[model samples]
Target: MTSFQMPNSADQINLREWLDEQSRQLGFDGLRITDTHLGDASERLNQWLAEGRHGQMEYMARHAQLRSDPGLLVPGTVRVICVTMNYLSPVIDFDQEWQRLAEPTHAVVSMYARGRDYHKVMRNRLQEFALLIEKQIGSFGYRVFTDSAPLMEVELARKAGLGWRGKHTLLLNRESGSTFFLGEILVDVPLPIDQEEESHCGTCQSCIDICPTQAITAPYQLDARRCISYLTIENPDAIPVEFRRAIGNRVYGCDDCQLICPWNKFAQRTALPDFAERHGLGRASLLQLWSWTEDEFEKRHEGSAIRRIGYQRWRRNLAVAMGNALADEAVSEVDKDELREVLRNALPTSDEMVVEHIEWALDS
Candidate 1:
């Protein structure tokens, strides 16, 4: 933590504009300021937690209050500085992305997780921005967050005029679409706030209609239990038998909603190399990723977000994808035969969770 310096009246008047310029120089795509209050979000959050929509992500429940009231998380935080960074790699062939997701042999890692970990990337950049703040007007009470805290990032960003929440529940901007990561700096400085942007979703339900698992049960409502992203990344148990076939070859995370959204046509490519595809994960085959030994998994995913799931969840997800691939008529008989042999071979050595998924794959 850096030392804090009190800001003068002139500093307060000009800080927001300076912060925006410096933030852009630091590689953030968008930035806005807003107060710490969350209005009715606290009540809505309470209801969501009570309904258990978060599935096995108990942390969402445990930190429910702190998330809605930013002041509670960082005392003296008068305003929040929200920033957006696009992560869509330039090399992405938008036309083939959906086709790859439906292909049984190719694994579809979520667009965001295919590169270096955003948690590190965002946190480092936010910290650098914070240092810039200290240099301009001295250090103030502030805390940086990059999807690493209990804060309601999407809500805060929406409040800051960064974007509006899409029907799929991710932040959507007219310029960047919903293919960006949001980070925040909770600060004591009372910077002028930006006007919130209004929703532009209209009657378009493309995201909801396109979700493979129908996880977005209603507009702006998501049952995480049915979300492929939640199932593949957050839920640490068996891949539910009901959703396995629908999961297809998505071994890690899901981006079907964003891919099908019309706004994605305007989605910008990331300027930072830290978000470029690493280890060829964007196009890696299920068989290739499945063959990684524990040591290889550790070494390959050292700086990648997918590594957080560990070997068990990784292999379990691959097994489900392989199972789906085995049943896919689109896959060649040779690939199905190879997948079967691989699943059978993996069964004997896998832990109970992975073994069960492997058996299910073989049955498929």
Candidate 2:
């Protein structure tokens, strides 16, 4: 944690220019800056939690102070930097696959995971961004992260004028919308701060309407327990029976809300191919994905975000999708029978939660 000291009076380095040059060379699409202030969100967060909107993702409550107070996480921090990169079109057919889920006969994976793991991609890029800063300012107290903790990424981004936070709680830019990932570098350089932008959600509620589980309880308020992302990736237990059928063909994650977002119309594709999908995940069939064993899951998801759910959740998700596919009138008897066989064999070796899901799938 080495640091460099700089005079308090600002000089004419044109931070915007240096930032643009460094980020462009480092292969970044965009950057924005914000003051350390977080706006009225602190009160809103308190109200959201007082209503128990967070649900089982208790970790959200633990980092409340660190999330709101940047100084608590990095002492002497005066400026926040935010960055975004388009992760759209990693798998070309993902949107089409999601559309197919309407048939209840196709497997639906979240659009974000249709490609490689973003954590690896963003973390590496954030580190690179940090390096660029160090090169300019010499040694400086800074930390880089992308969704690594409860650091109020969207709030900080909006504060930096990166973009406005939409009703869905994602940072949105006029040019890029919210289809990209947000990363940050906390620094104590006392850089001239940027103004926070006004929110643009303005009478729009598409995200709330599109959620299958009604996870967005209200504007900017989310109930994680009902969120498909939480249920599939966080819970690691039997999905509540009420929401299983509504979960549809989504095997790993859900992006219905984001897909329906108006802002995403401006979402761009990446120049970096590392975000590209491997193993045909964007259009994988229920039977195709369900056939994977523990070893297969491990190998296929090697550097992909899909690995977070692990083999157990993988099977659990595929079983639910297979059940949906099996029950669909559009599927062939041969495919249905094959799906049944896969579930039948998988049941004997599964834990109780998985076994219950498998049973539900079989019944479907």
Candidate 3:
């Protein structure tokens, strides 16, 4: 880690104000600072892991201790500058999303995944922000992180006054709602810290009530094994049959919880173009996405986070959605036949996992 002299308290206050201005100019929606300690969030993480609620995401457990203490993750780190970037593009319509969910033939990719990969976008901006800080105060001991690290980011952001944790376990802001990405910079400087936001959720279980899979077992408690996002994106194996019907037409992720939250009505559109929809993903039909060849999937999602799931899992998720569409009474016989024919055509060539899912779809 590079070291630099700390500014005096008066200069530090001025630097903090400068950071806020510069962060907004760089397209970050919100910025706040907090110390390295995670407090009780660490204990909750351990208990969640012990119960195996993390499902197959082994990295969460592997780096448990490091996640609780940022200083351990990056030695000498004292203050963490947390930033938020709203990812909800202006073109997205909540009502249209609900309509798409009702349309069994349509594929509902999560709004976040429709655009450029957030990891790359957030990571690049965070690096640039850190560089600006370095230039302002000379070389400093710092490390940038987006979702790339195992650290408790939501908790850090919550502690930094970015937002309060909702029942769905996502950070929710009064102004921006929960439609944003979080990034952090761990620095050696003891910057002025922000106060934590009080939970505004008060008796509101809308997120839990609206979950298709009951993944939010209780307020602030999620069973990842039952989450559609985890099932489609994180779990690498064949998705459990129990959650297949509940998964509906969601091929990438389910946004039902966020959609149901009253706070999300205030969700702000992103100021950056990185989150703009790509490849007509927001309006694609199940058949349209199903028709994508493996090469086409790779090429179309070249710079997308969706590409990381690989062709197999992508096909598996599509198969599940297609199956749900097949079973939907709303779909006409003609469309069902077409869907069945498509599944039959792919059966001869798909891998073992995809073939099983395809057979299940055909059964529907």
Candidate 4:
């Protein structure tokens, strides 16, 4: 059944057909129907929680049984429509780009945040899918969510056959690798469930070997506390000193595991323009960003995922990068002095968190 325009003759549109057509029209790389019953996913989630691997993601703990039970989050959630959209572009030199990240003179925003805020982009699309369903099936209960929800999105996605859970704990698919976002619509209406995609990780431990912080302790398990993405974005407290240097210029999130994955050769790009690179993001200079005033950062990163970190973390990240830059023997003395002056000026007036970073930048 096509997910788009259901046959005109049917009084009740086949949801399976509707989902397929809409996913195609939405430029989503893949979509699959799934049941809300996460089953073993719920059990594994409980064990993961008990292990405390989630760190300070207390929300994961708060959900309790709800994390596994969609009926608790959205009652009568008979079907879960899981979708994935590839956001990577071809020709990005994985090694060279990450090397630049190691260079203190460069600022490294995560590949995902180098573009627009995916939350804004994905939420709107999910809402549209919900609206389409309402139009077809009449006011059925539904809720649209991306990463923001506590519905164990990866579990649902895996069940939907969108992708297999790679060793790195991300959904990996042949069509797009793991460079994609996952979203789901939990609805009261039942739809035929798609079979789960089988794991293809095999003997390949590419993601584990390539992780800079060694966050992936094993093939299937990831320690989020050691993860750069969680450290930079989720943990607002002072970064654990041990991981700080390894963090390098990565101020937003980390993608070393994904970049090193051989499967990423198949990663696809978003058909929507929303995911394209923004000015001064993908390849901007460290010093150039250091010069941005709070207002400038706010205005430039408008509607960007980077904005969520706020300007202080933005400066803190810059200070860390500037510290790295200062380590570079090639930087001209004059440029180095100028960079120091910027950090100095930013210190007295900056917040405590940023001031600490500024001090670190100076000492570095």
Give all candidates' CA lDDT scores: 0.89, 0.78, 0.94, 0.80
Off by over 4 Å in 3: 1-9
Please estimate how well model 2 matches the true structure, expressed as its whole-model Cα lDDT.
0.78
Clashing pairs in 4: 1-17, 2-17, 3-17, 3-18, 3-19, 3-20, 3-21, 4-21, 104-324, 104-325
Per-residue lDDT of candidate 3, residues 1-364 (tens digit) = 5566667889888988999999999999999999988889999999999999999999999999999899999999999999999999899999999999999999999999999999999899899999998898777888899999878999999999999999899999999899999999999987789999999998999999999999999899999999999999999999999999999999998899988899999999997888899999999999999899999999999889999999999999999999999999999999999999999999989999999999998888
lDDT of 2 by residue, 253-322 (tens): 7888777888877777777777776787776777788778789989988998889878888878777777
| Model 4 bad stretches (over 4 Å) | 1-15, 89-96, 328-335
TM-score of 3: 0.98
Q: How many backbone collisions does model 1 have?
A: 2
Per-model TM-score versus the true fold: 0.96, 0.92, 0.98, 0.91
Clash totals in order: 2, 3, 0, 10
Superposed by TM-score, candidate 4 places the C-alpha of residue 13 at a distance from the truth, in angstroms, of: 11
The candidate that achieves the highest lDDT relative to the unseen native structure: 3
